[model samples]
Target: MDHATPRVKATLSDEGQRLFDLFRRPQGRSRPRPGERAAMEGARWGRLTVGDTAVVTYRWGDGARPVLLVHGWESRASRYAKVVTRLLELGYSPLAFDAPGHGESAGDSTTLIEYRDAIVQLHEAHGPFEAVVAHSFGVTASFLALRDGVRARRVVAISSVPDFGYVVDAFCARTGLTPRLRDELRHRIERNLYPGEADLWTRFSVLTGAADPRPPLLLVHDEDDEVVGPEQARRIAAAYGERARTLTTRRFGHRRILGSPPLVAAVGDFVSTGAVSGGLPGAEAAR
Candidate 1:
């Protein structure tokens, strides 16, 4: 039986349905500030039309080995300024895009499928990316894109959720939605957003989809992460077996973990060496 099938059996009131819809839609879309824009002034910028929205992309450096940077929910490509600068210094081309509904991209809200399609479009136009550095929700979309055949030699999943269900659960908890309403919300999401895919949560889950012989993965999580717990990283690492390596940090939290000097250096070292080294401060194995 489908995981959401039992939940959908419960009836929901109109008010509950509306509340669920509101919770599903992303809020607080991030727009680049003057300083952020100025920081990216030297990069070449372009846009790709994905369905009804335009995804804004920025390219830094002229290296043949392209690396993709994916920002998390409610964030923009410019958020990875430090990482992009580091990648450039390491002789790798770093390409980042503002997802639809975030930053300069079009749309008021976007879903995981939309994010996946945007990644695919970018890959088709500017790919085969040597690696992808994805943060939070972007990790889910990036993994889905990889499963759908977006080529990448390696992946760095930073502050990632192991399952899409975690997002729905977090939403319900934050909104105080009743169990029936939560079920109805899942029903509506399945019907409206992912109608063609009956098992979206399972299919989109990195923990479930990651298998043997897949691209090498570097799972990075902060011990003090408030948005997504560090255990999510452990789950993903365990799922990928020997192909996956994890780096655990302290006090960096979720958003700040992206730009942490230690985290950035770890990513650079992983990409450059193709093997994770031991004795790095604040780093630990997943197992």
Candidate 2:
């Protein structure tokens, strides 16, 4: 438990209101650091509205093969700057956006359903993508979208979160939430956020969300990823069998994997492998 857990436990009320509030909102938004800013340069900027929230969107190239870039929780789209550059070199158009409640988006809190909606809308507006490149929580949101009918030829998941329950469990474990409070939080999630969807935890999972005969997947995870364990990738690959591939690395941890040159090159190469070259036919429509 961190310093706040004992105090929170002592002050807990009947409703477990404080715990619910903390669960609902991310601690903070991620911004581009000085060294990361250059990767964000020269992109067309636009806004996408997800339920009254204005999500910030960016497009990096006009290559015919559109590849969607999805960043993890507490991360901004610009964090994929290096990957974006690599995609551009391979003649693949890269599109990305800040999800509701994160980065430049207009919200302080968001849910998986909201993230799925944003992604599906983007695909409807600009896609039929060649592939999807997602990191951490983005893997979950993207998988949910794919299950909900957003189509992509291939998927690259970096530091993947295997399921929704894992997220809750990890959070509770990290914060040292009491067992009673954790149960209450789970009940509140089901009752408030997803009424009538009793199987949401399973349905929203990256492992099970993409049903059988699923799209080809590339699972990348660092052995030392403290945030999301490396074993998550092994489980996904095992489930998908031959449809999925793995790239295991060391020392990169959760976030640094996005910036690794060799890894980004491999991802770009994987995404562009048989993708045809040229400007996207409906490129102008996205405007």
Give the whole-model CA lDDT for all candidates, comma-separated: 0.82, 0.82
Instruction: For model 2, give the RMSD to the true fold.
Output: 7.7
Model 1 Cα lDDT, one tens digit per residue, 1-287: 69776565543456666775686566778666564565588789898877788778888888478899998888889878778777878889988888878888888778788888888987887789889999999999899899888999889999997778998899889888878778878888788778899688888788765654688899989999999999888888778888888888888899888778767787787777766655567666443
Each model's total of backbone clashes: 0, 0
TM-score of model 2 (CA atoms): 0.88
**What value of lDDT does candidate 2 attain over all alpha carbons?**
0.82
Worst 10-residue lDDT window, candidate 1 = 6-15
Per-residue lDDT of 142 in model 2:
92
Best by TM-score: 1
RMSD of each: 5.0, 7.7
Error of 1 at 174 (Å): 1.9
- Give the per-residue Cα lDDT of candidate 1 at 207: 78
Residue 56 displacement (Å), model 2: 0.7
| Residue lDDT tens for model 2, 18-132 | 7787887888988787766876778888898888999999988874789999988888898888888888888889999998888888999888888898889889988898999
Q: State in Å the error of residue 151, model 2.
A: 0.6
Could you estimate the TM-score for every candidate?
0.90, 0.88
Show the colliding residue pairs in model 1: none
